[model samples]
Target: MSEMQSTRRGRPGYDQQGILAVAVAAFNEHGYDATSIGMLAERLGLSKSAIYHHFGSKDQILDLALDAALSGLEAVVDDPLPASAVEASAVARLEHVLRGAVHVLIAQLPAVTLLLRVRGNTEVERRALTRRRAFDRRITALVSEAQAEGALRADMDASVVARLTFGMINSIVEWYRPGGREGADRLADDVVAIALDGLRRR
Candidate 1:
């Protein structure tokens, strides 16, 4: 038997990846629950059954779309930071990861946004959240190490500091435009300075 179809429309033989790409865009614009296979089919100029041919259900489509969104993040999480602690100062390493994260997040904004917005209402959403939390935990450990090394303030808890840092970076999704007044590098610089250094005139 052939693979299960997601909708009544059947399937499109070529470009399942293309179909998923369109689906991700639609899911981003309308939200996963709000979007439908019909909309995806219409957008792709395929029949609903065609979409079903590729995916077994709307949730299956979401799973694939979420996978696409999270692909970048997975790489970041997997890559080891600069090996020696001294060569890769905790703070410096954290900054490097954060900068890379900004690039990845911006480059994959739709998927990253979806990853950030997951609320655990479904299995896929819950898994995305778990992965996000894992990344956060890694950052938190870096912050704690930085604090121990006297690179960051020890007053605030590492977890709290990590959340604050992510809050600052994640907010970029709301206001950052691809070619706006502030570029990604400049924004990353400003963010690092504000987060790692104080504004007091020295």
Candidate 2:
């Protein structure tokens, strides 16, 4: 439906959020092109029309799911660091952003997994890909600034560091399990420690 399912319908049924969660999982597992409305409907136990009523198409669902992933990371980038961190050096700021990225990835693993799988076969995917590159550039700028300030090793290319840093963080999607014993904060801290230890100027 164009609106949420009525409260009278009971909580077992899927609403837009519930459906989108399933859609993200489906897309992540099968790839966006490999999935279909029929499969989503079957999984939700709702007809395709019900899904279409809530969303224009599978593309729309993907767009929203990817938004969920992007919003968290964007928040970390756009928001100022905590009071103590406000005057932190360039490398510290870079480390803060990078650590926050790991937290974002862990918090939104499923949506991010879907985002990382996008191949630009459709307009939605292309837009997502563009936004991703823009985010990468922002981080790369931070890397370059740290290098210029003599905070990071100048020998390595900033762009290479950006790619390798993200490559390692994003790789968590392949194996990191949510609600695990190690917890989000520890994982993010460990990632920051490992990534920055090698990057900091000796």
Candidate 3:
């Protein structure tokens, strides 16, 4: 359906996307398991049936929100490097992926935050976790290649490095505030620097 028609069909000024955003926020605030369709309806000032009109169920909303995050991260991992970076070393490509991840995290903060909190309780959460592990494997391979090329430290296990790097990136959701002291670009740069280059002086 056209955007106009979809908007008119739903509550005024609220369509599926708007409703999904509010639902994500609610899920993040109260644990997803604790949240319900009734709560989302109340938060949106609409009846439960109105919510059902847009979504099949609360699980459907969770599925969409998780996909928002997973797709962003998957894109970062799957996308080919730019022409300049295509010939770059594995470490450089790794850095590029890391920067991209930081941007995705910042841009899709709510979805990504919701994703990180998932514990594989339901089929939706399990599917997200599975995709997340695949993403991690890609990063681990890149880290291994970089180490083989003598760019990154060899002492650490590649999978461990990958997890730790993402651990730092994932931690941003707890503290990052959009339009605050730092912007996404700066945060990306800082994340790459700290993850690649050690905090101790060279």
Candidate 4:
């Protein structure tokens, strides 16, 4: 099967990973409902049958793309912040994770955009949203911990803080384009400053 899929239209042969990236970009640009298999084939410079040969349906591509997108956030959620950078402080850890989330959004711009835009209309979309909410819960716990430690303000509810913080980071998909005047690290720095400054205890 691999040998048979060596080349299609002088481009690729069953390159699901590469095809997934293109599909994600198209989905992000035109919306998942608007992007068609025919459009995907044209974007990938392959035939519709070639795309169908690898993916049974367009939803499969969406599933894979959502997988690609959510994995980055999940990886960040699962990671243990190094003691050197965070100094075992819940607030520091929260800041570190928030900053990292921006970098992930920048790095996986297209897929993350799709992840943010999911409407839960399908099983795949619902599953992706569930994973996102799970990540949100994790951040909320961190916010709660930070407040308990007197690191963050407790005037507002922790869940509200978490929601607003993520609201800012998630909104990046709407206006962020690659090759911007600022790098991801710089954007992370600026975003962290703005997010943490407002949340920090006076």
List the global CA lDDT of all models: 0.78, 0.86, 0.92, 0.85
Order the candidates by lDDT, highest first — what do you get? Answer: 3, 2, 4, 1
lDDT by residue (123-151, candidate 3, tens digit) is: 99999999999999999999999999999
TM-score (C-alpha, index-matched) for candidate 2:
0.90
Across 29-70, the per-residue lDDT of candidate 4 in tens digits comes to 898999999999887778999888879999999998888778
TM-scores, each model vs. reference:
0.83, 0.90, 0.93, 0.87
Q: Arrange candidates, best TM-score first.
A: 3, 2, 4, 1
* RMSD in angstroms between candidate 3 and the native structure over all alpha carbons: 2.5
> Per-residue CA lDDT of candidate 2, range 1-202, in tens?
4344545445447777889988988888888888999999998889999889779988899999999998888887786788988877789889889889988998899998988888888899899999899999999999999999998999998999999999999999998987677787898887887887854666
Choose the strongest candidate by TM-score: 3
- Model 1 — which ten-residue stretch has the worst lDDT? 1-10
Per-prediction RMSD in angstroms? Answer: 5.6, 3.7, 2.5, 4.0
Error of 2 at 86 (Å): 2.4
What ranges in model 4 sit over 4 Å off? 1-14, 83-87, 198-202
Q: Which ten residues in a row have the lowest lDDT in candidate 2?
A: 2-11
Question: Which ten-residue region of model 3 has the weakest summed lDDT?
Answer: 2-11
Between prediction 1 and prediction 2, the one with superior TM-score is 2
Name the better of 2 and 4 by lDDT.
2
Lowest summed lDDT window (length 10), candidate 4: 3-12
Q: Which candidate has the highest lDDT of all?
A: 3
